[model samples]
Target: MPDQPVDQTTPRRGSRLSVDDWLEAATQILVDDGIDALKISRLSARLGVTKGSFYWHFTDIGALKSALAEHCRQSQATAASRIEALASLPPVERVEAMARLLSDPRRWAMESALRRWAVTDESIAASVDQLDCRIFAIAISAMRELGFSETEAHARATTLLYAGIGYVHAHGRLNEATVDDLHVIIEILTRR
Candidate 1:
């Protein structure tokens, strides 16, 4: 029997996959498993599609990896924008909001995964470092708004950023208690 013609447009189950869908699946896999688990075969399986669909969206694994890092960078920028939008709020309140945003479990996992990936990938390391600097700058700006001089604000923001990262790393998941603890830390940091 002659082979049946294959549909090139429609994906498996007639579900067309977009680039965002692929990126999201990649991010989830990266977070759930590790960098090594983010292969094209695995992502295609997770998305219920074929390698052709993956290739349709990304040129190769390297391109997919770059897209993942860019996606993460954009996510961080969105979070930073949220904090920046709260500029009208008191500095302490702004800090609390930033803390709440950073304590999100999904974000924590993504950051942890990226940190692990950075250990072996110099490009990813640079991206992660840039993200850290952007976050720190947002914190410092918030601190300066609270009447602290630039130097003091930088120092306080550095401490707060490190403490927040440590807290999230230790907890892995945030709850009311963690949030309350975070508020206390913010209070102490921002105290005159």
Candidate 2:
């Protein structure tokens, strides 16, 4: 017998999409259509499944939004962990890695979307604020590893993070010129 092509339009009677799948679809919708488009019906249509599948994964719309926020928080934590693990590398190299990570287009889109969402939601605003602090702490620690005093490292980390955020907001995508400019900025910021 030959294998049949799976039909995405209709899921099997007893099978359903995972929570991750729904989240990914919601993220995509959030990125492309903004928070207003992140409703369960829209996500179900995007995923080619039914609203029942979403309910199976999430108790309600609020639960889904909380899950999405948690996902973003986890992603930031993972990035911070990776940056911390790069302590063995030169401080300049570590700063460059962090710059590249911040400049990533996908991350920028998700961040921009979340920032937009945060404006109207206090919970999301709190999460964003916390994530920003964690990122700054990681950057400051990396600068300290490069022999910078605590105060100087804090100032430098603040400068680097602000510059990166400004660049991301001003130009969501990086070009060669931006990459070269980033290298220069990292060099200056990490200079001991």
Candidate 3:
């Protein structure tokens, strides 16, 4: 039999979308639009699934919203883990990875949306703040591991993280050549 054409608008028969699919779609919508646009009807239309499908996965829109917040928390945890894992690599490699994270404009879209939502939602603002503090702590610890004094570690970590935050807020990203230039600076920092 010849392969059947797949419809992009809807899922195949007997196919079921998982919770991750729903959550990912919701997060994308949250990023592309805003919290106000995160309604059940809108999400259903966006996902090209029925409203009943949403209820099968979530009790209500409020449930989905709560799940979305938790999903964001989980994402933050994953990012923190990635940052911590960078410690295993050499200093130049580590710095390059950090630069990639900062310079990738698409990397921080979800967090950017969260920040916009945070302006009105105090709870979300707190979550964003908590993530910031956690990243800063990880950064400072990484710097200390590199043999910097306490104050110096704090300063380098601050510079690294603030560069990322500033890019996210300013919607800027660095090119590969600039990132390559950063390696020379990292080489300087890591020399004993």
Candidate 4:
């Protein structure tokens, strides 16, 4: 299970933590334990600061969650840009580019965490849904340009996004057969 909610008590000692520090601490907590484990008190304690400091940076837990969501969104945008750049090579090259992008450990970890958090948080779920829609739009456009009908393009794009998410989340759970399976999936999905 995730760590208990943050301890919201007084600080142990030292100067107050900055917003960046709080965000970093929160991310660490989320990464190590999970969203359920993130508590304001525990986060403040983790930063060696008091819960009051958290108020300085955020009005409430919702505010802090918004910040986390923005951070994750920015990180995803950066990764998506990198993926797009690599995918610009050739149609064949795009497949490997996407595979490499989805297979990265850090990206997978962050996306998985964001996805899990989105499950219990409506705001986060909305944000992720928006991002997913935008990504699917891009993929659909690409598919359309590659000769698929509009409806077929959208369907393929949605399938690719779902498969990509599943691929990254189930990384360690797969064996060598996974790559072979992915190759077949790609062939079927990307074929004209």
Instruction: List model 3 lDDT by residue over 41-120, tens digit each.
Output: 88777677778888999999988888888888777677767767776766556766766764665666777888888888
Clashing pairs in 3: none
Specify the poorest-scoring 10-residue window by lDDT in model 4.
Answer: 4-13
TM-score of 3: 0.73
Q: TM-score for each prediction?
A: 0.77, 0.76, 0.73, 0.70
Off by over 4 Å in 2: 1-15, 142-152, 173-177
Candidates 1 and 4, the one with greater lDDT: 1
Clashing pairs in 2: none
Give a tens-digit lDDT track for model 1, residues 98-186. Answer: 77877776677777887788888887787777767766877898888889998899999999889766755665465433667777788
The per-prediction CA RMSD against the true structure, in angstroms, equals 5.9, 4.3, 4.2, 6.4
What lDDT score goes with residue 168 in model 3? 70
CA-lDDT, candidates in order: 0.78, 0.77, 0.74, 0.72
lDDT of 4 at 51: 78
As a TM-score, model 4 comes out at 0.70
Predicted structure 2, TM vs. truth = 0.76
> Against the true structure, whose TM-score is highest?
1
- Model 2: per-residue Cα lDDT over 44-88, one tens digit each: 777776778787888999899888878866866676676567656
Q: After TM-score superposition, what is the CA distance of residue 165 in candidate 1 from its true location, in Å? A: 1.3
Q: Distance (Å) between predicted and true CA of 188, model 2? A: 2.4
After the best TM-score superposition of candidate 3, give how far the Cα of residue 15 lies from its true spot, in angstroms.
Answer: 4.7
